[model samples]
Target: MTDIEKKEQYAPYISISRDEWKTLNGALNFSLSDEDISKLNALNEPLNLAEIQEVYFPLSHLLNIHIDFAKKLYEAENGYLNSGRKRSPFIIGIAGSVAAGKSTTARVLQKVLSLWPEKPRVALVTTDGFLYPNKVLEQRSIMNRKGFPESYDTKRLINFLADVKAGKEHLEVPIYSHLEYDIIPNRVQEIHNPDVVIVEGINVLQVNLSEKHQGPQVFVSDFFDYSIYVHANEKNLLEWYISRFKQLQRTAFQNPSSYFHRYATLSEQEAIAIAANIWDLINKPNLIKNILPTRFRANLILEKGSHHFVKGVKLRKV
Candidate 1:
């Protein structure tokens, strides 16, 4: 079936009301701890914690259940069929448009999931690492399309995920700098065997698993035990993007070596214009063509309201 058709057929195995979602932790009376609240407060942009509780708590509970089931399945299959081999890390993919707060979501999830005794070593890797170097993109004359899928080194990303999921003892992922908007040379992040690995990006569940691709050929998400798509209205997302851009103009964009340094002193109106132009020209198109189209492929969908609170969650039927 086509991806869209498959999404149309999706039904939730467990339906939760907004209130029920917040109380998923039984008598523990689910509440964000002071540390978590502090961390959320430290975010560059605003986030609604109550909304997160209502939306992500139930999702986390569902993920914990899935993790247990996967572990059981792995033990049964490996013990009986393959004579006992250790299963690799549980993988989760988080995808959303730019400024959709997906990075925050991923970080919060890494923190919350790690709190679970069974999954202590949660690791998060962003697909930014897979982006092609700016010099290469400039040479190819696609610098303006940097965040688009074609600008990423998909094969290398796939291989890295493959090795990590295969339980390779140590794996190194290339590092990319947001300030420079390019791959940092000779810099790598070491990932040991993590209980959970969360991969976040604009196109994690992109539904591009055609047969022609092979040799470490599994899509980045083929390794996912669970997947989430953070959803918000296009208008709100655009505004958030503009706001973030203005903030960056004062911060990272002010550095002489930063790629966007030229815009550091732009007037508020001019900065907004530039941000809007970039969003309209590049980000919006990529979202429409690549990112938003895959929302339904996610195992869970966190739908955010105008106030930026997760209003509900749609869980796919098993």
Candidate 2:
């Protein structure tokens, strides 16, 4: 290939500094209020509001467009038939490697999107809830590979989305507890037909990847009206994972009931080593073998730099 082609190929992962970020988002009209900025700043670490404006404002705008499109599609399909029935929830899928900040992205998106005038009552559901119960994982001898695609109750997840998409009222979902690392028995979170539902996890876009795999017919992503993947290089992601793990160890691990409490007593060096090992052995391999390959399938991509700030975005070509 020519140099130009090679450059173009490598350009998808390009970085944008905080200065350029402002320029990128300058055309977007959305801005966080002083209260919103204060809440975001009150996070464990400081963040630049200008950087957020550059990154997430455009994202929120795109989501607004996606919501509009979904509404139009719903109307066209039902309005023509003269039906006055309510439509189902608009589903969005968010997929990324562990410690890539997809969870944070989902939460931030939920907060921002819920503020919109047209689409209110947004709900966020995680595929983490669809994970097989810890008992089941232990019984199957696959406890170590908890985030793999096969570890999820894919059928139940699909059915849940299908029910929500069909405008089913009062749909219940099993709640998973991170502290206990198990599904709470006889408990469910009720979904009351919201305007948007975002399903996020490490393998949200992953299917069997082939017909011969004989896994299952319906994948969780098939129900999504839009999908997003947070992108970053493996090296940056490994560093980010280590940092998050250390923070979690200092905080969440202090809880008596946390599944990761055993790691709380480790020295700083020891903790870093353990976190690096987990990333190398589990997360990095999974990203290379499964998650990263699916980046091309996303409807849009949020590419971030080392500081966990989004630098650029790539939308799939029409």
Candidate 3:
């Protein structure tokens, strides 16, 4: 069955074709140049001004409407409680398989949302920073399962989200280096007060149950005011993963400091083989076992075609 047909089985979501979705782009006066799109595009992913107009433009507008409603809800609750309370940042969680273009979606949203007439302060954070250090993974003997849920510092990530929702200021987030393939030693990213926060990762919408828990459990999605999932078929995802791996081998892997520097010397066929193996052994299993199960949990879903272009959008009915 097709992706849209599969989605039709779920009554909670209203799926719309790309052509239909583009018509919802109301008079909100905004435009992004090709230069801007080039900066926002992820490695090997294609994003153009037309895609932005058809997809992201309406998405951003919808988010702004949600944000406005959220502000009003805060005010109403404060009044009902008869207490002076400050509004907290609206957290947005973006989750999907690796190489599904989620990073590009987050970056584009951050840029587009920041450009709104209100000019709200927008902050972007990836859960990669919350990943357990390579040393920790090695010690646990799960180094090969780097992207698995257990490899993440879930407690720390939950705490960070809690603090951000509590209006904490000058929060420090650990930095993860993709080139080094590990968390940085001491460097950190500081997040100040922002109107919106975009948390992007492979496992943002994931839920883990613990037998040791007594009361209620606090999940990462609990802190998100809105959530999005980027979706593509397994075949397309594998192809994109291998393509990105080959591009990295030509670029980042060539750096002497890169953790995968050995891959830089590999021939084209050898690199393709390695990439396919990694995807099969690591990424594909993770997607089926953990990530794909959480797709329906998202408030919005961006379905992509084989070319890395969004072909349809599914929004959860209120």
Best by TM-score: 3
C-alpha RMSD by candidate, in order? 4.1, 3.5, 2.7
Clashes of each: 0, 0, 0
lDDT to native, each model: 0.81, 0.79, 0.93
Model 3, range 142-175, lDDT digits (tens) per residue?
9999989999999999999998998987688899
Would you list the clashing residue pairs of candidate 3? none
TM-score of each: 0.89, 0.87, 0.96
Tens digits of lDDT, candidate 1, 21-98: 777743323457777766854235565566556555656777888888998989988878966566888899999999
Against the hidden true structure, what lDDT does model 1 obtain?
0.81
Candidate 2 lDDT, tens digit per residue, 166-236? 88877888898988888889888887868888888888888666657664577778888899999888888
> Would you list the rank order by lDDT, best first?
3, 1, 2
- For candidate 2, report its TM-score: 0.87
| Higher-ranked by TM-score: 2 or 3 | 3
Prediction 3 global C-alpha lDDT: 0.93
Looking at model 1, report the run of 10 residues with the lowest lDDT sum.
Answer: 25-34
